[model samples]
Target: MKALIVYGTRYASTTEIAAEIGKVLKENGFEVDIKDSRQKDIDVEPYDLIITGSGIKIGSWTKETLKFLEKNKEKLSHKKIALFAVCGATRDDEKQYQEAQEKYLDNIQEKYLTKPPVAMGLFGGVIDPNAKYGIMDKLIMKMVKKDLENKGIDTTKPYDLRDWDEIRSWAMELASK
Candidate 1:
């Protein structure tokens, strides 16, 4: 079987996650191709499975990911599709996880996709002040970091909030299906 995993990221964390998923799919006997959503003229019709993902910044999907979906929706509707998003909300709160899923995944499915995806994943994203952000973004992240800290969550130096176990488990399940 063949699989294509395409995604967009702001600070490269989503790119890392996409690679891991592709590796798992490969291990499960799939021939996997991973691409950045910003790439041009991608033909998804050749793949048996299509997985797409994005990095969420300030409660929004990366524009490139959205554009990719818009460009490929018709072809993707006929393929086995899965969606994932990396966001900060899925970090520590169960309720926030549900809300983020509804907003980032469910609502996106309703708007851009004709059929529901085979799976939708909402995972925690990293927050790092040292990343390549504009001055305004740096200021905003400072406040966001302070707020999370005040809530008793230790915003560690790197603040890498992802759950690798959950991500790997989700991929394993997808490979099974």
Candidate 2:
């Protein structure tokens, strides 16, 4: 089978996850193409499976990914599509994280896109306080840091928290189908 893996990432974590998925799929004997969602255009009809992922920021998927899905809803519905979101919040609170991710999926479903995504996944994201950020992002991070500190949460360490085995398992199942 052939698969297309598309991703939208701001700090490159989601992109790394997407590439890893593609690598695992390829190792499992399926042909795969990995691309950034910002590509000028995507020809989705040629692929047997479509896997799209994005990093979640402020309880929402990236705007570029949403736009890609919105623009390709018609063509996408005819193929096997899988969705995933990378977020730091999901590491500790899966339910809340998934609910936030579902809002994006719900929007796609509401658009009347037949055959919505067959599978959805959430992966933990990376957060580096010292990393460069835009004005708004910096402000938001500062607020979040303050809140976490108030709650006695330590924010000094960087944790990956992504389960490679789980990711591989998911890809294997999708490839087997």
Candidate 3:
């Protein structure tokens, strides 16, 4: 089987996650191709399975991911599809995590990718001050970090909340199906 994994990332964390997913898929005996959504166009019709993901920014997906879904909705609907989202809300609270999942995944599914995916994943994201950010973004993150800390969540240092084991397990499960 052939699988294609495409992702939209800002600070490169989502790209790393997509790469890991592709690696596990390959290990499970599927031929896999991975691409950044910002790259040149490629047809999705050749792949037997399609997986797409994005890092959430203000409860919205990257424009590239949205465009890809919109442009290929028909072809994707005919293939086995899986979707994932990366966001920092999972690091805070259960209610926040659920809300993020609904806003980032469920709503996106309902609005753009109308075809149901075989599986969907909600993964925690990283927060790094060193990463490139505009003045407003940096200011916002500072406040966010302070708020998290006040809530008894340690945000004094960079946070990488991804669960590698869970990611690999999910990829393996997708391969099996």
Candidate 4:
């Protein structure tokens, strides 16, 4: 089987998650190709399964990801698609997780897809202090961290909230589908 993993990342956390998914798919006997939407374009015709994902920012998926989807919507309609998204907001609460799924994953499916994905995952994301964040962006991140801390979330310096086990489980399930 052939699988294509395509995604957009803002600060590289989403990139890492996409890579992990690719690894799992490869282990399941797939010939996998991973593409970063910002740097490259792909012809989805050769792949049996295509997994697409994006990082969320300000309640939106990365623009490049949306563009890629829009560009290939016609061809993608014939393939098996599995969707996933990475976002910081999904980590803090159960309610927030569902909301994140609805906003980042479901809303996207509704807007761009004619058919529902065979699998969907809404996963936690990272906030790396080492990334090239601008002044305003830094301020916003700091404020968000402070708010979480104030709520007794024990915010760390560089928040690494990704749930690896859950991520792996999701990929394994996608392999079956």
lDDT of 3 by residue, 23-123 (tens): 99999899999999998786898899999999988778899999999999888878999999998876458898888889988998888775788888999
In candidate 1, stretches whose alpha carbon ends up further than 4 angstroms from where it belongs are 152-156
What's each prediction's clash count?
0, 0, 0, 0
Question: By summed lDDT, which 10 consecutive residues of candidate 1 come out lowest?
Answer: 151-160
Q: Which lDDT values do the candidates have, in the order given?
A: 0.88, 0.78, 0.88, 0.87
- Candidate 3: residue 66 Cα off by (Å): 0.4
TM-score of each: 0.94, 0.86, 0.93, 0.93
Error of 4 at 94 (Å): 1.8
lDDT of 4 by residue, 1-177 (tens): 999998998888999999999999889989999999886667899998989999888888889899989998989999999899999865558888888989999999998888999999998888764455888888887788777778676555667789999999999999988
* Residue 168 accuracy (lDDT) in model 4: 94
How should the candidates be ordered by TM-score, best one leading? 1, 3, 4, 2
What does candidate 2's lDDT look like per residue over 147-168, in tens digits?
7678676778654657778777
Q: Against the hidden true structure, what lDDT does model 4 obtain?
A: 0.87
Cα displacement (angstroms), candidate 3, residue 171, comes to 1.0
lDDT of 2: 0.78
CA-RMSD of model 4:
1.7
